[model samples]
Target chain A: MATEAGDNATLKRKAHQGRPVSLMRKTVIHALLLGVCLVFMAPFAWMISTSLKPKDQLMAPSPTLVPQQCEAQIDGAWVAVDREADDLDITCLLVRPVGTSYSQVILPDMLHEGYELLQTVDATPDRPWAKVRERLPGGEFGELRVVPVSELRYRAVPQWSNYKEVVRHDQMKFPLFMRNTLVIAALGVIGSLFGSSLAAYAFAKIKFRGRGVLFVVMLSTMMIPFPVLMVPMFSMFKWMGENQLGTWLGTFKPLWVPMWFGSAFNIFLLRQFFKTIPNELSEAARIDGCSELGIFLRIVLPLSRPALAVVALFTFMWVWNDFLGPLIYLQNQEQYTLVLGLQAYQSQHTGAEWHYLMATSVLIVLPIVVLFFIAQRTFIEGIATTGMKG
Target chain B: MALKDHNTLKGLAFLSPWLIGFVAFMALPIGLSFYYSLSVYPLYDEPAYVGADNYAQLLWEPDGSGGYGDALFWKSLKNTGYFALLSLPAMMIVSLGLALLLNTRVAGLSIYRTIIFLPSIIPIMAAAMVFLLFADSQDGVLNAMLAKIGIDGPDWLGSEAMAMPSLALLSVWGVGHTVVIYLAGLQDVPASLYEAAEIDGAGAWSKLWHVTLPCISPVIFFNLIIAIIGTVQYFLQPYVITNGGPSESTYVLTMYLYDKAFQYHEFGYASAMAWIMFVIILVLTGLAFWTSKRWVHYQGE
Candidate 1:
């Protein structure tokens, strides 16, 4: 729709337009858009800011926008502490303090002891200290200087190495978790996709008897809460001599075997996407001397790339992020996925040193976020358009 | 004759994978679970043919504790049902409203969509952590913000009265998927219908009621089915946020089953509970589909 200018612009050109209606509309729309944008962006802004603030600020009665500078005795001499500066710099005043925990004290505590905080050199959570070389007594405090920079050059410190430390924190190492996650997700994607695609193709393309009823029965399984199945499924697996995999495959079949059967949601999505393909293509393939297998591999498989991608992406995500599945199925920590590893990380730390836990969470989520960015359009379309033909 | 035989063989070959998977993985396991539900098969112990004891215990036993005990099973089902009931309607309406608001001819609509979808991308564990901070009863961001408005906020995740509702509200925060679905539905509502409604002197409310709602009923139906199924299986929010605490108010069926099977190792009774839940979901979904003939309007129909 074009901006209607006949009523408002005609009056404007007449030089007697008291109020510009279109302009008012534009202003109102702009303000509304800006307000919504703010609401959307607030959580992210809060996360970043809260991460930077000291732990005390996180639970403060009245929250402070920025941390306050405090003074304390650094060495024998007094030194100043200033947090607002971009580059943290410390000026020395007195000699070194007797206590080794001098770094633990905030700059404001040092300054209150009569030491002026010249500047804050660094206030990173990784390195909380602001290094200052204070002057001896009777020396001018003016010559001593501290500078602060806003940017925390964490990369310069190469805290990425701490990622390794995070991994090795307990039995829940990143490499082991990554290996398990990749293995399980790979098997799950292959199994579920293979099974679901076949089942979906039958439901969508085949003109078999009882196809509709079977499809409805299959889709109806979607309503069964997984927990409802979890208990029974475990008992069945145990009874099926799954533990006997120790003698056969030398590993439990619980990891990947279940997906060889179709999952209700994936089958529904694949079936819907499959049905959108015209039957004429399959019929034409049959006329061209192609068998059903040939038609599936040559015509249908190649035609269903987008749907396959959606299926694979979703399977990868669900299986990767699945905590309950791994928590139940996998017995050994060696078999744990990344979600299990995160659980272990939290349990190991028991809420102590939240920074490490948060840091590890950031590491874990980064790859998933990257994957989402890469295939976001398809992901959104895959989910939203499932209703188009239903 | 050989070529004709080969063609039939190929058809069977194409269909073999699904047939094999269905029989081996799904049908066998499901059948076995049914049998096990009739017997007592405790993990790390020999199975015993205790004919209908597990089911009976689930139904009539006032003595048994945990999964077989009727109180816990019924309580969990009630809690889970309560969660689904409160969250689904609120989430659907809020999502539709958001979709309608974003559907207006506004610039940066993609930005709004991205903002709304942001929560879905957040790892559930991370979101739980954030909510822990935000919903802290004493000095939380939620309570502090409310203090500014001169209204004292009650304990959200802390009190039994508010825990499940708090979890339900948390579910709505990730209603991004629903909003996207509604957007697709709104797009399909043919601009012509709105124009015709306007031409017939229908105001915005009347136009929405007559033109918009009817047009999107099928999409709403689709979302409703998916939402109900998803909510019934809800575990992560309650598991992480409340830990099924505040006197087990947020203890859902899934959580109960999980604790039984994994934590307590009561395999036989847990299996029975699971089977009952499966039957409940199956009947409910069947009923929904059966009733859709009346309300769920197809475009051609």
Candidate 2:
């Protein structure tokens, strides 16, 4: 009985010990997961922070994730400064503090006008302080006081106007680019859905001669790299332009017109989804005297809403993000998509004005990110199904 | 029999749009591309037959004295190979590791999954722009962070040595799609095998090696071929970020091809390069498939 009692106590102790150990493990795992998430999100956070920075703050020697406004210590209270600059020779900055107006004075041997100071300083034992007569804010003359540059601090102030400036930048024409992208994406999505779904319906439902061979041929085309077709496609578009289309090279036609016919991948995806639906529904519809086109339109499409949504979302995102297509075809700035415009913006202003550049990038990426969040399930499922089957 | 004929006619009608597209876009382009690869056909000029000179120049020509020794073709191929060598393994390992961690019964798994998958959805152009800002030599976020640890960051896209690696690193950052795919593959791994391994006194490492690896081998193989193809055709990131600059360090095959076709108007040469890339991709894919029989495990086989 004593041994049994000892066994019971040990078992209870073991159970008691297991609780905190598991809790600790959970905490550790959670912490690790959080750390990984932060690493993954760090780029986006940096992009957001950079996008909100003003032009001047963007070029600061040490980059700050938060946009900052310079502040000066005045009358023992930190007051915001419109402009502050530290002289190369002196420790103090000539700051135009808030709540006071000061005139600029061109000092002797100074390249630019120096801001009038309020006080003067005598030479200190440790440092050699320059003595200069300067105009005060109230029009009084006094020696320049050397305030340490370290007294100035920067406070976080997001520049909301960066986005506005980026959009309004003369070279970018962001709004026009966005409109072009939307028109192309919308038309392309509609065309792909209509054409590919019809093809998928025929492949999935209707019995046809050479259907097997044709379907295999379509799938094999997907394996052919885009580079292989790019040259000839360009030539074909050029040929069409010469014959009738009137320079299709610089137009949106080359970008979206191809979609009006169909894409192999979309057809394959829709076909897969269509195959999963029981043929009995289509058969019954056929028995009900519905035409083949009517059966496809009414029966197959209605039942394939989820798959259709997947197709639409993927197509929209693909068109939105496509760079090579626009890069190859669109020669004029007016014809440029958002992706192409962003590239143009980058090349035009390389290594400078990153704030505006990042803002532009954010503008381009935000729509798709929002779309993904709204249709997360479809996006995940579409990607998974495609990867698995492919 | 009459109904069968009617169905066939209807099917043909339904397939007409795609059939026309296939002929106009795919079939014609491929045939013309093959022909273009053989002849010296500038955009404005009639095709003058060169008879495999473009292919020979790309494959064997060592000097421009023979009218086709840019040497960029071989260099770009090497650069692409280097990029794939570094990036493919890094992506697989990191994505698979993330997949394993995510496979655990962690709290808020969906949130983690979403956050990790977010980067993949970002447009490559946008991602390239963001990386360009991040990889700035002076005052870039990446370099600034590196300074905190007392290391000076190299000019990522500027220096010859670091440019390809930088591009590869960029590829690594966008491994979210691969991670999602691996996560799906991992979910398909039966729980019973893991339980069996646990009962056999296998530790976590052994269980992962014996049970998990075999189960997901096919998925890995699939991702591998996809990555290989993608790496070979890697154009946008380099095109946007480097423009194949800093002494042509980051120039890959597709960029070279684009420069040939668009910038230099060497349509015939570009077509030849495209054919070479196609053949390379096919061989690599075929090689992977051929080797898959030795290593890739299929369930119930």
Candidate 3:
């Protein structure tokens, strides 16, 4: 790992200092990269945009990335209004029956007997206005009123309430699920650190017959999909639960217990890193009559902290993003992780409650993105140089 | 010899955790799954010995009867295959393209790299939720943007033709991780090769095609294999976005296997399907390894 970083440092120097690409070429490349970056970020950007949008604006004919709040003069006061016209011209009546505080902008076609058109305002597209009307629903109605299309304002204030509401969603107990996910993730990381490192040390530093075969076997296990093991593992866990072997299926046990069994990917990464720690240090320790575990604890682990961190980061990510594992194992709603809770938030999705859903997604996604920014150097180059793992 | 014996004993002792885990958790479960495949193991009932019948029904049962065997099995497998065919190439090209772009000296290169790589690492489930908003027909951002250009976007996740492609977009967005892998490989490509190519009067395109590509072919190979392996188990999006609906156009193999096992309690059929999937993965990865001999070049080799 150290050697690779050294190589990259020299490589970065040469590539930058050597290349004399034309100014025109650099301009073209940067422009292209900027465009690509925008395209890449659009979904996430849209997620943040939608999460803040007012629920009414969610079904706008042409949605804007920024959430908007539009208000027009209604009943002689500037109040919230939804534009309903897809046209430049329409004959409408502004009506306020006696005793009603609000007024209604009614089109001629739907004009009722009691609601007579007191005045026929020939409302043009630009100067479209009716006498003081209602502050109400969206394009589901065609009542563009007192304020002109030009006069109506679109503000970009984010609705932070969506976050609050999504957290408070009845089925999605986000705090509870978050606690569940964290407990599971933290335990899994601890397990990986404990279990994978010990095994990786033996694989890298110890010599035993069939060790090569076992190492290869471990590498090949990384290729096996979760589906292949999903069924039998489920059956085993369920059986254990039935037999009172500490409640595997519904609790967090099934999620974290298997983590204690060293994973192929974590083991492989640690083995590579453990191989890098100089053998002379271990030989010196061995000559001092330090036991193998003693040497591993006293010398090897301290040097391999960065590698162990990468493994922990990766494990935390896997557990946090894991949908299928939680989907199958977690039958009870209260026991769900964030992923399953997000799934519950959108159970009846038809684009109606997208603001809430997006808010929940952002909450779930925020930690990982923040973590990446913090450890990006190690996370990027470490995973990059290692090249392949889960 | 005495020292070697002592080391070996300690080695075995240190590895006991993994060894026990392998035998009990991995090996035992794998063996049991195969055993369950040959029997009619309902969730509630004991396993009834029915040798080879599950396999026969899954492979040979015909005519969309939805009886003993689901004809949707074939449809789901085809969907998975379509996803692989669609996603794998896009992931490779886009990721490699981004990497090549990143490799060049640009201002704020780290920022560009970060932006490109960010999507790949976001929780897949979070990605699915975001895509749900993006692919939504009524008010999704994609269609809204499309409306600006006078192009009415199809219901991305709803329509039969557009569903898998919509999914491919989601898959492609996450290739930022792959780009980093390619970036590492590209950096490892010696500068001397490019200098030599430049002296030989190679144009930019020529240099990229001849010098750069061959150098990164091994990375390309590794990325392609992982992408293939990953695409075959395409689960999260379909399960979240579509649930294999709109005439089952997006029902991938893993979804069907999941439903059979957990939802419908057809554990035997699911296990049989799983084994078939395992074999398919082996064959595909094996084929990748086999084909690598011709295309993949090593530094020393």
Report model 3's interface C-alpha RMSD after superposition on the true interface residues. 2.7
| lDDT for each residue of candidate 1 in B1-301, tens digit (9 for 90 to 100) | 6765664455345446666765655666667667767878777786677888887876776654444447877788899999988998899888888777666665677777777876776677666666665677875667887898998998999999999998887787778878877777777677777777878899768977898888888888888877877777788878877888889899998888778777888777777877887787777777878887887666654
- Of 1 and 3, the candidate ahead on TM-score is 3
User: Rank order by lDDT, top first?
Assistant: 3, 2, 1
Question: Against the true structure, what is model 2's DockQ?
Answer: 0.47
Candidate of highest lDDT: 3
Better of 2 and 3 by TM-score: 3
Clashing pairs in 3: none
lDDT of 3 by residue, A251-357 (tens): 78778878887899889778877877888998899899997888999999998888888899999999999988898888888899998888876875556688888
Winner on DockQ between 1 and 2 is 2
**TM-score: model 2, chain A:** 0.78
Query: Between which residue pairs do clashes occur in model 2?
Result: A120-A143
Estimate, for each residue in B174-232, the C-alpha lDDT of model 3 and write its tens digit. Answer: 98999988888788788888888889999889989998899888888878878877888
Off by over 4 Å in 2: A1-32, A72-87, A90-151, B1-3, B64-69
For candidate 1, the iRMS in Å is 8.7
Give each prediction's root-mean-square deviation over alpha carbons.
9.9, 9.3, 4.2
Q: Which docking class does model 2 fall in?
A: acceptable
Q: What is the per-residue lDDT of model 2 for residues A318-338, given as tens digits with 9 covering 90 to 100?
A: 999999999999988998899
Worst 10 residues of 2 chain B by lDDT: B61-70
Candidate 3 lands at a TM-score of: 0.90
